[model samples]
Target: MCKRVTCPNDGKPTWWGCGAHIETALAGVATADRCDCPHVPVEGNPRMFEVKKTEDQATA
Candidate 1:
């Protein structure tokens, strides 16, 4: 599971990329790799949850 994407269509967050919305978001991000969606912050859930960095951000 890709813990860096969500249902962009509904704005609902997910630990794994939502198969339905991922493709949608992926099309929008020019730099997205494979199923990676650039719009998807490396941080997972954040509804009332706040984290300074996501997995990708940490790597960077």
Candidate 2:
């Protein structure tokens, strides 16, 4: 089962669990409150991590 988590990009609600229970984890969450940021794919590289900077943070 998936668990609810805060989106790192915008601090919106998101899911962090198996792909099978994505919809179940986000049930009842408002559409606007959902995080729509693109996520880095984790298929072959389980140990890989990525941190995306926002436009403001990129210019700093």
Candidate 3:
């Protein structure tokens, strides 16, 4: 399995790849081993999230 990591700059999830690939994908920016970094803040309440349907999905 590939290692799952979050991007340091955008806080987006990234899958495992070679060091060079990871670095290139991240644009040479360093990343943390885990999520919940300062760039991305987790909500204390789960209710804050809403499941929004896309236009196509909504129409379907």
lDDT of 1: 0.39
Best by the lDDT measure: 2
In angstroms, give how far residue 46 of model 2 lies from its true place: 4.1
Deviating ranges (above 4 Å) for candidate 1: 1-19, 28-32, 35-60
Q: What does the lDDT read for residue 39 in candidate 2? A: 53
TM-score of each: 0.20, 0.58, 0.24
Per-residue lDDT over 1-60 for candidate 2, one digit per residue giving the tens place of the 0 to 100 score: 567777666788777654567678789998887887655535575443223447775586
| Model 3 root-mean-square deviation | 11.5
Residue runs of model 3 more than 4 Å from their true location after superposition:
19-60
Q: What are the per-model numbers of colliding residue pairs?
A: 0, 0, 0
lDDT (CA) per prediction: 0.39, 0.65, 0.39
Candidate 3 per-residue lDDT over residues 1-60, each given as its tens digit: 234555444445554433335345445344553333232112564322212333554486
Backbone clash total for model 1 is 0
